[model samples]
Target: MIQQGDAIPSVAVKLVNKSGVIDGDSATIFGDGRVILFTVPGAFTPTCHNNHLPGYVSAGEALRTKGVNRIICMTVNDHHVVSAWADASEALGVVEFIADGNATLTKALGLDKDMSGGGMGTRAIRSALVIKDGIVEAVFTEDQPGQVTSSGAPAIVEFLESMPS
Candidate 1:
């Protein structure tokens, strides 16, 4: 797994946001300011919907006040599903839902995996990264399948607070 101070993969992908699709640089999108980028196995799944995303939304204000420029929730799902999920959670006002339909970003990050047993196909592991000026400041990744590890939003917030400001 990636770790603090690692240079994030300089990659780009097509992502769908509320504003529509965009060709975004993984680095630039997280550059210039502090960013919290999180990945989930799939969208609308039990843990992802009820736990993962909601926690981030609930922690949005605190994260921003701590210098987080953006909180991105990415999944190996399409635009429509991402849009609906964000809307249903009322998270459109708090988080940015990004569709990684082709796993382009996931693959580039070397976080792609086959989750066929769960019927999720290829997806990224549940993970979180704190980036500052395009450089990784921290990373929390699940140890293996079916584990949450230290990747939760609240954990990420705690990690950020522990950092030297």
Candidate 2:
């Protein structure tokens, strides 16, 4: 898996917004400023829906207060599903949702967790990445799937606060 100080991959994907969708590369997404990007295995899953994304959504303003340029939520879901999930949860205004449908970015980062036995197929491990000026500043990946600790939003914010300014 990717670690702190490693540069992000050049995988391209689409961001789904209420108004429309924007195509972007991971590097370009974090180019202008610092970004806190979190990934879950899939969209609308129990842990993600009930806890992961909500934690980030609630911490949106606080993350921005700490100089985070964007709060992004990524999943191996299609654009329409991602859009519907964000809209249904009322998370459209708080978070920018990205559809990594092809798993190109996930594989490049070595975060492709296997869940074929459980029928989940290949998915991303729960992880949060802090990027500044297009480079990774920190990474908080759960030791395994089904765990939420440093990968959650509050912990990520604290991690960012602990970094040198």
Candidate 3:
């Protein structure tokens, strides 16, 4: 799995927004600032839609105040699904959504899980990463698929609060 000090992989991703979809590179997107990149198993899943994402939406301001230049929520779904989820969550302006349609980034970071048993096929494990200038500063991965313990927004806020200023 990716760890502190490892650089984000340079992979192509789709940036989905209300305007439309845009092709983007992971390295360029996360390379220049303090970023909070959180991943869900899949977009609009029960746990993800009800619990995980809402935390980040509510905590967006707190994270930004702590120097997060960007707040991103990524999933192993296509641009259309991600865009709809972003709209439903009402997080368009507050949280940016990225579509890892091919699970390229997930596999590259070693965070991919075979969710075929659940009929979801390959999916990203629930996790969060704090990166600065493209290098990982912290990694919080949930122990189980349904539980959001270490990778939740509150945990991230606490982690940032404990950082040396």
Candidate 4:
């Protein structure tokens, strides 16, 4: 699994926004400035749609005040689904959505979880990373698939609050 100080892998990803989908890479997305990248098992999943994502959406400004440049919500689904989720969640302007359509980025981070038993196929484990200049500064991963204790926005805000400025 990726840890603090590890460089983010260069994997192709699709950035979904109000305009449209744009082809990009992880390096470009996370390499420039402070970023909070949170991953969900799938788009529109109950916990993700209701709890995990809404936390970030509500805390977007607070995160930015703490020096985060961009907040990215990623899922192992296609851009279309991700885009729709973004719109449905009212997160279009607040959080950027990324589509790991092939799970390339998820696998590279060693955060892939097998949900085939649930008929969801391979998906990303619920996790969050604080990255600065492409290097991981902190990682928060949930112990259970359905819980969002450590990876939630409140935890992240607390973590940032503890950091020496």
Question: In the order shown, what is each candidate's alpha-carbon RMSD?
Answer: 1.8, 1.3, 0.9, 0.7
Candidate 4 residue 5 Cα shift, in angstroms, is 0.3
Model 1 stretches astray by more than 4 angstroms: 144-149
Question: How do the residues 26-135 of candidate 2 rate in per-residue lDDT, one tens digit apiece?
Answer: 77877779888899998999999999999998999999889998888889888888888888878877789889887888898888877788898888889998898878
Return the top candidate by lDDT.
4
**Cα-based lDDT for every prediction:** 0.81, 0.85, 0.91, 0.94
Residue 30 in candidate 1 has what lDDT?
71
Instruction: Provide the lDDT at 102 for model 4.
Output: 89
TM-score of 4: 0.98
Clashes of each: 0, 0, 0, 0
Per-residue lDDT over 74-144 for candidate 1, one digit per residue giving the tens place of the 0 to 100 score: 89898788877778888876788678888887887777789888787999889998889888888788886
lDDT of 4 by residue, 1-165 (tens): 999999999998999876779999899889999999999999999999999999999999999999999999999999989988988899988899999988999999999999999999999999999999999999999997689999999999999999999
Give the Cα error of residue 31 in candidate 4, in Å: 0.6
Worst 10 residues of 1 by lDDT: 8-17
Worst 10 residues of 4 by lDDT: 16-25
The candidate that wins on TM-score is: 4
Candidate 3 Cα errors over 4 Å, as ranges = none
